[model samples]
Target: MLVSLARVASESGWVRPIVDGSDVLEIAGGRHPVVEKALAASGEGPFVPNDLSLDGQRRLLILTGPNMAGKSTAMRQAALITVLAQAGSFVPAARARIGVVDRLFTRVGAADDLARGQSTFMVEMAECARILNQATPRSLLVLDEVGRGTSTFDGLALAWAIAEQIHDVVTARTLFATHYHELCDLAAEKPRALNLTMSVSEVDGRVVFLRKIVPGAASRSYGIQVARLAGLPDAVLRRAREILANLEAQEPADHRHKQLPLFEAHKSAVEEALGQLDLSRMTPLEALNWLADQQKKLR
Candidate 1:
């Protein structure tokens, strides 16, 4: 796996390695070295390098960044340096010094094993479980977008718990990438943890990624920019804006209030509507009023 990481990093041109203690990882670089290289070959500049260091003081580093801002690339480059160093080959970085690791675990890039009849979420959980069960103090664990397979609250809860375990229980050198900004509070409380993020800029109402890693927390993820970059239809983009407004206006998931399932609420309304249907007993005028009331209720 480390070899694979190195090959990808070598091709990308921007994956530079940094050594702080016994750990070896790339500084600010792309996520998948292979993919980054391909883009560079087509004349795109590589992402800006961010600050990544491993001092024995902090074993777990939390990476926070907007989508497509190079969090994954940074993760991949770190893994690649490990592979290159172990193979006794020159790495793609300016420098590197590696700590010995019994095993390197990555929970990035998960998909369903359909041939095995497993759900994507199940596969994700399985990978996470593997990390939690096997990681040791000397291990290097990279987890990307954990708990995205479930509801927001469930995912956040799982991410928070997993981070806590990785820090307090496994005590491994970890790089955790997440959209859950709320988890930054853990860094405030834990001495062995730190928060870092990719950089972004705004120009003429457009956002550009600086790709630099800096010490701090991410403010927001421009999901709309990512969607537009993916070539979403204009109408879809407009509707998405509407949906985002509604989502944002809703209560935050971290709040104590319980959430109701939309599908279950819809089903309950259907059942109630069915029970209200009594054609035999209703006069025409009364039936019209009842229908109108039901329509209002549905709305």
Candidate 2:
């Protein structure tokens, strides 16, 4: 394995990363060796290189982009480079400087523990819990799609809380790739968190994956475009587009409600309903009926 790795490093022009004891990681012109080799074998043009820099002040990256836009590839490459550097091997980058990590944790991809009767989300949460509990300030963590197996609200909530914990509590050097764009808000709240996204462009109404990492969050996931590329039936694609448009149209109202506190927003109505309740004179059956009426109003 060492000999083959050396051969690949030499043939592909990989560089020797500078391993240090400080809390900093910097990579310039980094490429995934496997992907580069595959592209060379297939003559599919040169791979795009991206630069990453992190330190004690910015220890966590919240990466968001459309599916298959190289988010996962870039994140994996960073982790691989870190591991190679710590192992005293050359990494696939023009330049790299990585701090020594006490532990490396990766929560990527999805699978079920069928033999143990666990669902996909259960497996995902189990791995997530392990990382949260074990990761420390000196650990390196790469998490992709951390809460994707659950409902949108639940997934976003989980992803948000996890990002906060990793940033505020664990303080690990992390690369988090996720489809939940709302998680990008962490960059604004946490000094140690930053946002990154894979670059994409459009030409003649078709999406093009630039495969380049850039600062800032992606505005949309472009799932329909990806579905179209995957050759989904035209009828289904059309229906999806329509549904997407309606959902987007409703987003403003949804966002407004999301911004409000649930209890505070409903306080006036609750007070009014309570004012109508004659609790002192009400019978047990009357109280039950009033409770049922209030519950129906809530729904």
Candidate 3:
């Protein structure tokens, strides 16, 4: 098992990882052993390696990028490297170090349990609940494409709350691969969180995957472009691009913009007032006051 990891960093590098004392998990130039061999056998281009750095403080990594951009691969490699490092084996990295992990938990793609009468989203939530309940600070979690099987707002809200719980309460080391670009705001709100994205390029109106993971958030998902690559009809692709432009104009790119808690009191008061209001019974003063409160909350 420890003999794994190559293309990016071979096991022959022999950088034995320290797992007992340090409050960190760092893997430089890590790659999937299976993927490396598969790519080599297929005579494909070189495998792209990525680096990971996590510690007790900065433990949550919010990974965002387009579809088929290697986000899942990067998360899986990080987990594999951690497992090997803790097993007292020379890791497949230029260098590797980690605090001993008590348990490793992962929730990948959505799945359905027919025998259990659980839908895909239900099964996903069940697994997530278990991980959240059992994982500790010393544990490592790899979550991929969470909140993807449900409606946009529901999934986004669930993902947002789940991320907050892990960052504040669970405090587990995590590599979360998601398509939610707004989650990059986590890096702003939480001191222990950071953002990562897969690199890509736009050349001659086509998208190319660089397969490299780097710091920072991606601006958008290239689903339309990918569908074109997948051989969707040219007319369909053109219409889809038009619809995408319309949708983008419908809402701000950063839909869930981050704002400070400076208006907490005003916000609470406004919400409470709105919840109790009877529009038909409102006086002139009441209308004026409500408008003023709404303006204050906005600011």
Off by over 4 Å in 2: 259-299
Index of the highest-lDDT prediction: 2
Better of 1 and 2 by lDDT: 2
Question: What local distance difference test score does each model get?
Answer: 0.75, 0.88, 0.82
For model 2, what is the C-alpha lDDT against the true structure? 0.88
TM-score of each: 0.75, 0.85, 0.80
What ranking emerges by TM-score with the best candidate at the front? 2, 3, 1
Worst 10 residues of 2 by lDDT: 259-268
Per-residue error for 111 in candidate 1, Å, reads: 0.5
Tens-digit lDDT string for candidate 2 (49-77): 88988899989999999987999889889
Give the residue spans of candidate 3 off by over 4 A.
1-14, 253-299
What number of clashing residue pairs does each candidate have, in the order they appear?
9, 0, 0
